[model samples]
Target: MGALHLMPGTTFSNAEELGDYDPKRHASLTLRELERYIALEVVGSCHQSIHSGLGRPPIAVWREDEGEIPLRLPQDRMRFWLTFLPEEERTLRPDGIHLFGLRYWSPALSADVGRSKRRLLVKYDPRDMSRVFVRRPSGNFVEARYADVTLPSVTLREAQTARRTLLEKGRREVDMRSIIRTAMAQRELVEVAAKKTAAARHAKARGSKSKVDDGGWGSLRGVDSSKPVPFVEDAN
Candidate 1:
């Protein structure tokens, strides 16, 4: 199949008047906007215009033609489209699924355990790596959503980076299970540290409050520890 280049003409050309053209100037339009303008206006005009070579309007000739045109898409077009999708190979673990820094698990993947092959194919969209599709031997794609294991504050990029950094040490081949286990352990440690930091801040705040009260009481120089203290009456 040959490709046809469709371009929009801004104005009618006159060879006698070269002043109509300016070499330094070009159309100030984005590619998308230009394509839209051409499709909506220029192409429509051309379709209705009588073609000098064909002796008929392009649309009329196209409609009146009796020969068959290839309009149907191929059955394997989906597979071909999927060929461009980024592939992430992962093995299902007993605990759950983990890939691209975020942990993921589903009942379908859980059932895929003990398969004849240990490795499973995972196809993901680069635009949104939060979910992936797992392919089975039967050529069926199973949708696997992202696991909710990461903290709400953690972004998708951060999650993917965290796993990438974990897996990228010393160029040694790493097992999926071990990588996930280590990552989970590290995550737990981080959680514990975060909790400890929060608790420490709370304790410090409480201590400061106590200290302020103590300072207020201690600032009184003439307080008699042995004497019975009388409560101050409100002057209501």
Candidate 2:
């Protein structure tokens, strides 16, 4: 299949520019094949650019201003939209593509879990089919919306191997809840400290103003005392 290279904000004027393009050739792809193609094209772009440092510019398949990429497919087949990040942004971490994430939208919810927010959804773990509809908040996995997949059967040894791979890939050791809680606590502390500093500044200003007013009153008292003795004798 010919590669489709889409640039952001540019109109794809040349359907002919898709050199040796043959839609009929891939027309026989099954639903699974199409899904796999979508996944591979999107994730492969990200992985190659980010991890490999292969000096390729990221292609923006979906126009950002368009809100979402609209895909029209046969009613019987599942359809999805794929978007990828730029090469430079993708390589900050080992699992940067996974951490960065992608959105998957389906017109009909899959049979696994029947919660119907079939509009737009994000997935972090592309390899793990079980993590199909889970959402991430700020580079951390927060919650799963319609998680109803059975765990893949694997031997204990295989599970251990997978765990080791995760650790090596910088994907493991994330205590998301603890990290969020600590961040919140730190933010609250900063806010409280700011309020206290402001209050102290106001108090200092008031104290300085009070001292100036007291000095003015003292001067007035001295002048009154100097003039009071003569008025008091005349009244007597």
Candidate 3:
């Protein structure tokens, strides 16, 4: 078992010789593919395999140890969930809570507005940028989602990329609406590009099967991409 350690966060490192899910070997490894590979590796194999130090599979050891003591659960599950998410200090303006050039608001936060000007504790999940947890003066956590509810949810990386694109286009100020539009447009182009690349690769590996999603790239078939549209310009 050489270097059989689990990777941290979003950076997953495969075993030295695993044929499947090797990023270097499988150049077209997608996010979904990584998730499926991890699910199989950890639950299907690792849980059933024997541990060198424990002398037994982890699941077996966990079951045997369960009778020793009862695990204490959190009284408030919402609070417990927010405890582990990434957090920051943010100002709660009348418009809403601002973070990463996006604005968040909640009906629960209306009562506290103008009472006092103080920075609120904010917690967010990086995977979903649709909502954030804000700690009010009363010390209770409230969900503050995007002020523009119609806007689609995007990851932190997507938002940042959109912001950078706006700056590169000579836009002095980048707003939330521009970020959303640019990110979504960029995502569409990515889907198209990925399909084009996959079609070329499929010609070579036609005999082999794949688990990647088609992701509606078929609709983009034969679409002319000679002149791609630029990112959404700041309307200021």
**Candidate 2 regions off by >4 Å?**
1-172, 209-236
TM, every model: 0.38, 0.22, 0.71
lDDT of 3 by residue, 1-236 (tens): 22122221122445543323333322555566766766767766677779999999997898899899798999999999898999989878888899988899999999989887889999998778999999999999999999999999888888989999999999988889999999899988988987887787667556547433233122223435567844332254
Q: What clash pairs does model 1 have?
A: none
Best by lDDT: 3
Candidate 2, which ten residues in sequence have the lowest lDDT sum? 85-94
Q: List the residue pairs that clash in candidate 3.
A: none
Q: Write down the RMSD of all candidates, one decimal each.
A: 27.1, 29.1, 13.0
User: Rank by TM-score, descending?
Assistant: 3, 1, 2
C-alpha lDDT score of every prediction, in listed order: 0.56, 0.35, 0.76
Runs in model 3 lying further than 4 Å from the true structure: 1-25, 206-236
Question: Residue 53 CA error for candidate 1 (Å)?
Answer: 12
Per-residue CA lDDT of candidate 2, range 181-201, in tens?
333455467568757765775
